[model samples]
Target: MVSVYKKILFASICIFALSCKSKKEEATKQNTTQQATLVDVIIAGTQQLSNTIEANGNVVANESLEIHPEVSGRLTYLNVPDGASVSAGTILAKINDADLQAQLSKSKSQLSLAEKTEERLRKLLAVNGINQADYDAALNSVNNIKADIQLLKAQIDKTVVKAPFAGVLGLRMVSPGAYITPQTILATLQETNKVKIDFTVPAIYADLIKRGATVSIINNNEPKRTAVIVATETEINTTTRNLKVRALLGGVPINPGAFVKVLIDAGKQINSIVIPTNAIIPDATSKKLIVVKNGKGTFVNVETGLRTSSGVEITKGIAVGDSVVVTGVLFVKPNAPVKIKSVKNLTELTKEQ
Candidate 1:
């Protein structure tokens, strides 16, 4: 009975040891499989961001107008030189002036007959063969006919349409023999050679926007072009709190209505740390960034400054030489170990695309 009891106790101890060892091995494997999350990062450094204020802008033709007739009539002759240059005072179109011309002719014949009758009445009055009232009526008829002729001439002039200024014509909207009214648009004219940059800036910069002050223009990430401040709206917008500004472009003409960026020199360049805009982690209370420190991702709060087409300025929280996680921001957890796949510079991290 003692020998049987010893064997049973030994088997029970062996089973218990095996069970404990298996659990330990399983836990060890789980820990090893739970590796660090891989991510790409950018090294923060002081960058020379343009010490300028940036704003959205559009290319505007210096002079633009819709071609409309002063008088309404059937267009007997239409000469819309589409996409062609025209000089001031050039006749663009003509209305049917035949009726006005015929009226003018009839008035001239009536004036001639009235003048003859007035002369005969004057002669008769000289001899006391007619009353003074009769001579006066004859004289009044001649004056009335002359005035009618003058009125007809003025109406004929209104039937013609002329270019107001030298400009390039746009597509024609009306065809010949079309009975047009004052509201009808014949075409559009624009001075394409001269273009102005139209942009709005914050009202706080109102005092800085002066007439004839030079500013910079950038398009498609190309080199900067210079433009001079030409004019500004008198009052600040009540709704937007922005001041409308127009600058004259001095270089090659940009297509009207094309989007461009305006850069105004705001005193000096800002040499501060900047990071990719995507790397920012927006929080409810403050902005944050995933920073890699000692092989771990730590969320750090940061204050931002002037933002440009390239990157955002980091005014506070992030330091120079810090590793800021650019990619895999959502997958990273606070105080969790992360794998650094590669480090990039400010330019390589983000582009204006």
Candidate 2:
């Protein structure tokens, strides 16, 4: 009986040891499977980045003119229609010049009579039939009459309106036969072959913007054509605390008053790592990023610099050629196992891409 009891105790001990070992093996297998369930990651390299600031602006003509009447009369003939294309010296409108014409005719008749009298006096003076004073009076009358005729002619010419410059005319403000004065507006003309985009930048960036500094302009209405900055205002606006900038657009026909977007480089180039804005993970303690190190996924805190629509500059906590999980970073944890499905090749990770 003693021997049987001893054997039973030995059998129970063996069974207990095997059961504990099985449990330990199962726990180990579960932990390994959990660690292997991490998602894949891809990486990018640091590169020199360019920063840009975007602003809203308006498209304007380089030269704009407001056409106004120079003579007080009824607007008679509008030779140029509304929105008409006109060249320099093109007749735009006409005012009633009957009064001016009548005055001119009277002056011409007086001038002709004065000339005849002067000629007769000259002949008489040469023959000693007239006094020198009388001949001088006749010549003075001719001169006065000629001046009167010239003044009348100038008035008449003022009644006819002509384009000051070659451009497209805006809507006509006065119609035919409308009573007009010198203050009356006839039309507006705008030169549109090369357009200007006007924008204001912050006063802090005034030093960076200079004359001939390159800029880009994007039209909200037409996104295809981009304008280049041609000029900048030398002085800053005191009231607005901003500096004025103008960009020239070539081959794009833009009308005055059209809105546009302006982009200007701050003139500082940096050699920092840039990544898409969405790749940044913001946390309360620090700005973090999911980076792939040693073929495993990890969380790394990073410092950021200038931000743009496409990406943000990584100032620290990331290195060149370090694979970062850009798309699926939200579902990852530090030191987790990951599968790298796609890696951005060196050629694809360059500055432009």
Candidate 3:
């Protein structure tokens, strides 16, 4: 009976040891399986980022001329119709110059007679037959006659109206046979091949913007067109604390005084890390993101720069070729084990591991 009791105790000990070892093995297996769960990661690369400023403005013609009569007379000839396309020096209107033309012809005849008299007097003086005073008087008379002819010619030229530049003419304010003063508006001419966009930017951005800076213009009635800065005001407005900028847009059809939106690039390009917008998680106090390091998920706070429609620029808290959790990031915790199944979504690299 003593030997039988000893045998039973040994059997009980062996069974207890086996049960404890099994429990330990089961716990180890559960931990390994939990660590093997897969998570999606995006490998991001560096990209050149451009900063831009958006502002609203209005479109103006590159050149505009207001046609006004230079002389006071009866408008006799109205040659150009309203909204007529004209080239430089195209005649638009003419004032009554019948009297002026007669006067000009008379002055030219007198000038010819004076020139003949002056020549005869000079020959007489050379032969010592005429007095010096007589020759001097003849020369003065010839010069005076020439002056009168020039005055008459100038007055005649003023009667015929001509276009100062090549452009489209506006409505004619005066009609034929209407008496027009110097203040009379004959028409308006505006060049429309290239348009200028005028806008004001904050004073802080004045230094960043300069002549030749590229801009994008979107007109209310036309499609978007690319332009460049043609001019910039050197002085900033004191009341508004803004600097004025003008951009010239060519090859695009736009009208004067039309409303437009201008977008200008503000700064130099910088290499920065960018990620999809959905990948970033905003915490209560700061912005955070999950990165896969050494097959483990790590949480990091990041500083962002420009925000675009597709992604946000990561200025800090990340580097190139870093695997970031783009999907299922909210479900991950710090120091969590993660399996990287792909890295192609974040960059141009092909999937290998």
Q: Give lDDT: candidate 1, residue 27.
A: 88
Error of 3 at 39 (Å): 34
As for TM-score, the candidate ahead, 1 or 2, is 1
Could you tell me which residue pairs clash in candidate 2?
40-339, 43-323, 43-324
What's the true lDDT of residue 322 in model 1? 93
Q: Write the per-residue lDDT of candidate 1 for residues 1-353, one digit (tens) a residue.
A: 99999999999999999999999999886774476788999888998877788999999988889989878889999889678899888899998988889889898989999999999999999999999999999999999999898888888988898888888899999999999998999999887777899999999888889998998898886799999999999999999999999999866767788999998888777799988889998989999999999989999999998887678999999888999999999999999888899887777665533
Q: Which stretches of candidate 2 lie over 4 Å from their true place?
A: 1-48, 203-208, 221-230, 266-305, 310-353
lDDT of 2 at 147: 89
In model 1, the runs with Cα more than 4 Å from the true position are 1-35, 111-147, 219-224, 235-241, 283-286, 293-295, 350-353
Q: After superposition, how far is residue 19 of candidate 3 from its true place, in Å?
A: 59
TM-scores, all models, native as reference:
0.79, 0.63, 0.62
- Deviation (Å) of 117 in candidate 1: 6.8
In order, candidate lDDTs are: 0.89, 0.79, 0.83
* lDDT string, candidate 3, 36-148, tens digits: 54767777787777776778888899889888889999988887688878888888888999998999889889889999999999999999999999999999999998888
Candidate 1 yields a Cα-based lDDT of 0.89
Model 1 clashing residue pairs (backbone): none
